[model samples]
Target: METSQALLIYNMASVEKCPETLTAVNASSKQLNCSIDTYGNNQYMCLPNAEKSSLVEFCYNGIMGIQVEGNCLEAKDGRVILHSCKKFLSGCPKKPFFNYDFYKYPACQHINLKHFCYESDPSCQALENSGGFNNVSNDNRDIMYGLIGGLLVLVILTIVIAGFINERRWKRWWWSFTGVGNEPDRKPDKTSGTTTNPGL
Candidate 1:
């Protein structure tokens, strides 16, 4: 019997803390929307209705496909290999999880890790590999082009038809005003005993 390969997974954990490192903070409080300090850490002093400062900590963990030396985690070929054991940790609020200077260890500098992992999932990977999104985008582009082309053709046709109608109307008005087409030839004025030349 053949054994199946183990599928790698990514996981994230988060915790909120108050001024005291060991004390837990309420996540549902409206005052959590405080401003961050210059160092990118949350300013506990800005928390409204708060008696003390607070911070949030996030930890990441998972298994790496390959072994790495030292404390470095592998982020090769856009894959993150978690080297650290899954452990609950604390850190300053507003700081990123991968900031080595603030919260040490298991650090890899892949920005947007959550998005990368989501795309790497088997279902999403299949769609991407098969050009699902690409196909949709292409289809949308084609539809837009077709609509623009059709509108341009309609506008041109309208302009041509309008010009034709205006030209006919102008000809009719000019003929009526000048009496050019239906004028009768002048006849002799018998009562005055005078005859006018037809050419004149």
Candidate 2:
């Protein structure tokens, strides 16, 4: 009889200092309504005091999936619940958990972690053998920059060539307009009118 080997799975462990929630957006005006530039992606608007200065910082990785641990979330009324996911944040949870509607529910059920599980923002499985498009995106950006640089160099060369041609044309035009000793190979033409001015 053939038997199947069980798959090994690991739970990711993370340390959360503060159980603060977050809202996300760009623009300083909106950030003021939300919070500070923590992620710097300008993706998340923050909630006031939602983040702890020391312990709230979390580093999650794709290797083991994810898990979160932080101070118990305390509601304004003083009820506490385990703060594991983004729901406990001052802002909306963007993931497996909640949204702005969560705030509408009574505080009695606000602290639930069942909704959040570590997930690939884009299905990681789709990019599995595709050379990690996220990583490749950076290389593509570099290639674009190089192409732009090459184009700029070409433009400068074209401008320089055009200017050189224009300079020669201008010199020819100036000689034709003013009739200055422009003939390098011909001698001056003279007529005998006893003193006829050749310039006339």
Candidate 3:
């Protein structure tokens, strides 16, 4: 069986695990030092695209229906600081951050945007319970494989049955042709008390 691949988790537990500095705006713009640690095993399922020139963090909080909290990033005293975090729908019709969306993963279906928090958060204690996109994908793949395997088995069975029937016919033909220890199709006529062609 093929092993299933796990989804990537962006753990911001420590500075080493997280990006030390990200471009505040664009690659050409000033770099911002990251310090937005919730200190509760900051595990992020999805993150904003760093390639964009804007400095914004997308946090999912389920206050309304699947809200995405947009926290503006600012450089203060040579360090990056979260200016303000606001709530928006998961769809983020305004497109809060540059290409920041959370509905991309199927696992997001089970996770409430508002309940999303640091690993230490009580609401996130059951984070593992939330199914992942890979899990769903793997399930679908397994079902497809099962159906294909069943079809193959059925085809093989049909072929084997056909071969068996053909083999029986072949054996009968061979026995008749070779006449090996088998009676001939024609027998002597008893009424004439002599061996003669049965057809005659």
Best by TM-score: 1
**Candidate 1 segments whose C-alpha is farther than 4 A from its true place:** 1-136, 181-200
Model 3 whole-model lDDT (C-alpha atoms): 0.36
Give the per-residue lDDT digits (tens) of candidate 3, residues 22-77: 33222211122222224332212223222212222322221111222344322222
* Candidate 2 RMSD to the real structure: 18.4
Report how far residue 31 has shifted in candidate 2, in Å: 38
lDDT of each: 0.35, 0.32, 0.36
TM-score of each: 0.29, 0.28, 0.27
Candidate 1 is scored at a TM of: 0.29
Clashes of 2: 11
- The alpha-carbon deviation from the true structure for residue 93 of candidate 2, after best TM-score superposition, in angstroms, is 11
| Candidate 1, lDDT over the whole model | 0.35
Per-residue lDDT tens digits for candidate 2, residues 35-54, read 22333322121111122121
Winner on lDDT (1 vs 2): 1
Residue 97, candidate 1: alpha-carbon lDDT:
41
Candidate 3 has its poorest 10 consecutive residues by lDDT at 1-10
Q: What is the C-alpha lDDT profile of model 1 across 1-200, one tens digit per residue?
A: 11111322122112332222212222322234433334443322101011112222322222212232222232222233332212212111222243222223212221122233222235434545676445567779899889999999999999999999997787768767996652334455689855465897
